[model samples]
Target: MSSKVIHAIYTDDDLLMQAVKQTREANYHIEEVYTPFPVHGLDKAMGLAPTRLAITSFLYGLVGLSVAISMMNFIMIQDWPQDIGGKPSFSFLENLPAFVPIMFELTVFFAAHLMVITFYMRSKLWPFKQAENPDVRTTDDHFLMEVSVGKHNVKDMSKFLSDTGALEVNLINK
Candidate 1:
C-alpha cells in the first residue's frame, strides 16, 4: 500500500520552519514533525487542533466523585450505621468532613487513571507496541520533517531538502 516515508533533518528551528513554509508553498503534504524539545507555535504552524483531553479528564473526575459519594452514602447509611464522631452518621450532609477525603481521593484517582487510558486509546498505543518514530536521532538533538511526495519527482524533493538546509535526508520503507 505504498508505505514510503521520507525525512529531512535540519540543525536549527528557524531553518526547519523555513523548510516547512517552503513545503507548504510548494504544496507538499507533511506527514509529521519531530523535535528534540517542545517548540512554541509549532502546532499552529502545522495547523493542528488542540486536544480535548482536559474535557475528558474533567468528566472522568465527576464520575469518580459520583461513585465515591454513592458508595459512601450506601455504606454509612444503609449497610451499617455507627455514631462515633458524635455527629449524625446516617446523614452524609451532616458530616461531610469525613467523606471529603474519600471524595477527593476518588476524584484524583479517576482523573489520573482515566486520563491516561484515554490518552493511550486516542493515540492507538498499547503495552509492548513498538514506536513509530522515523529516526531515533530525532528524539535527541535533531529536528525531523516527514513528508509524502505524490505526483512530484523524487529529484525535486531532494532539491527542496538541500535548499532547506537539510544536513541529512533519508527514505524509510514500511
Candidate 2:
C-alpha cells in the first residue's frame, strides 16, 4: 500500500543529522534516511535497537567447531583409523594437533559466510533485489530523510523541515 511521506533533502550530513533530531523532538515519525556514505551515530539518533548479528556469528562458529570435531573424530578415530606418525591411538584428543588447522579454518569460514548471508537476508536484499530509493541525489553527496505525514498537516511538516535546515522538502506518496 502507498502512503504519503515527506522527503527532506540536505546537502550536508550535519544538517541532515540536526534535522533528524529536531524532527524527532517535534514528535514527527521518520520513515527512513538515505545517505551516500555511512553516518556515525545515525542509528542511535534514529532510536534503532542494537544489532544481534554478533550472537549469530558466535552460534555459527560453534556449529562449525562441532562439525569439525565430529568429522575428525569419525575419520581419524572411528571410520578410517589413520596411523600417521607414531600416534596410532584411537582418540580424538590424541589426534587433535593434526585437526587444529581444520577446526580453526571451518570456524572462521562458517562465521564469515553465515554472517554475510544473515545480513543480506535481514536487509531484504536477496539476489537480484532492487530497492526504490526516493531521491537520486542521496546516492551522490546529498542525504534524504523520509518522514511520514499521517494525521499531520503536510504544509506544516514541510515548513518545519525546511526551517530545520532541509535544503528541499517534497511530498511523496509511496
Q: Which candidate comes out best when scored by TM-score?
A: 2
Clashing pairs in 1: none
TM-scores of the candidates are 0.88, 0.95
Clash pairs for candidate 2: none
- RMSD to the hidden true structure, all candidates: 1.9, 1.2
Candidate 1: residue 74 lDDT (0-100):
94
TM-score for predicted model 1 compared with the true structure: 0.88
> Candidate 1 lDDT, tens digit per residue, 1-174?
776667899888888888888887788888899998987777777767898999999999999999999999999977887888576587888768888999999999999999999999999999999998777887888999988876677788978887889998887665
Backbone-clash count (model 2): 0
Q: Which candidate comes out best when scored by lDDT? A: 2
lDDT of each candidate versus the true structure? 0.86, 0.91
- Please report how far candidate 1 places residue 125 from its true position, in Å: 2.5
The global Cα lDDT (0 to 1) of model 2 is 0.91
- Number of colliding residue pairs in model 1: 0
